[model samples]
Target: MKLPKELVNGSIIFIGITAYFLLMVILGYGNSFYLRLVNIFFVFYGVNRTIQMNVKEGQTDFVSNAVSTMVTSLIGVFLSIIGLVIYSYMQGGDDYVQSLSETFLFGGNPSIFIYSVSLLFEGIASSVIVTMLLMLYWNNRLTAD
Candidate 1:
């Protein structure tokens, strides 16, 4: 059975993010908060690829495309968060989260649950924004009438 383009693209995003973060750690830049922003480009690339695939298949309905894009991004985000939780526990649970709280949005020390929940909310917001922006770009490029 063939996997949906959204799953494939979402996996691409997850792999890109995981690899990028691991590289940052290996290069001793894991604590650099600014570098984290670059991961959004991976999300953009994956979501855009899904949209492009839909366009190629002549499935350009705005709502469906938007849903596809959201699914792609959300998959990446959820997987990344799950990975983070696992890594955090491996590193020392709350202690690891404490170390990251300095650069992360969480004020004061946070447990792994708190950190993961905070990030999940942030991810959902970003996914929505990315979906809307990409949908607007595609809608303008492809006319329904």
Candidate 2:
């Protein structure tokens, strides 16, 4: 087995992000069961790439890649949190509470006017988390070799 350091990292991040995305979709437990299919497909692609990638012997740039991936991902997370807070504040806690009670978190409550806004916030948060993790994995993996 030609254990090249760079290739291993690539595969981990590619697969990891796909897993994370699929998990969020699964947690939905609402109406999306095909999430796993997409994730698995991505995992396959990552695996294929890993197998094809050349893990040539050289100075493994793990440290730099790790730092870049971690730092930028942290920033993404921080910004997402801030955005969520601001969005929630705009909707007003009282209104949000009322909507939550009325719609039950599905974001579709004809009774509540704020469900759409809340759903948007949730989607944004989810996007941020997904992006952050994927970014970290990609950066690290790409630089490892």
Candidate 3:
């Protein structure tokens, strides 16, 4: 059975993010700025591909396109977060958890549950933002005839 275009696009995004993370680990720069910056490109690529796939599949309605973009972003974010959690556990969870707490949740250490919840919210926000930006571009293209 063929996968839906949305799933295909999401998988692409997830794979790209996971590959980047692995690359960072290999290069011993897992938490570096440069590697993180590369993730922006992955997001853009995912959104672009989502648009292309939706159009190709004759699902060019704005809502359909937007849904596809959102789905793609969600999958990317979910996979990225899961990968990070695994990396943290592998590298020893305490230091990783403490760093995250200091960096994001102020000083006091947060439980893993809290940290994961925060990550989920961040992912949702990312999904919405990417979807909105892509939809704006796509809308213009659609109207530019």
| lDDT ranking of the models | 1, 3, 2
Model 1, position 118, has a per-residue lDDT of 93
Q: Evaluate model 2: give its TM-score.
A: 0.32
Worst 10 residues of 3 by lDDT: 98-107
Better of 1 and 3 by TM-score: 1
TM-score of each: 0.96, 0.32, 0.84
Ranking by TM-score: 1, 3, 2
lDDT of 3 by residue, 31-143 (tens): 46455667767887887898987777777799878887888888778877787677778867867777756635346776555677787797788789888988999889887
- Model 3 compared with the native: what TM-score? 0.84
Candidate 2 error regions (>4 Å)? 1-60, 94-145
Of 1 and 2, the candidate ahead on TM-score is 1
Q: After superposition, how far is residue 128 of candidate 3 from its true place, in Å?
A: 0.7
Candidate 2 C-alpha lDDT tens digits along 84-125: 345446657456545444435353333333544554465445
Q: What local lDDT does model 2 show for residue 47?
A: 31
lDDT scores of the candidates, listed in order: 0.93, 0.43, 0.77
Error of 1 at 114 (Å): 0.3
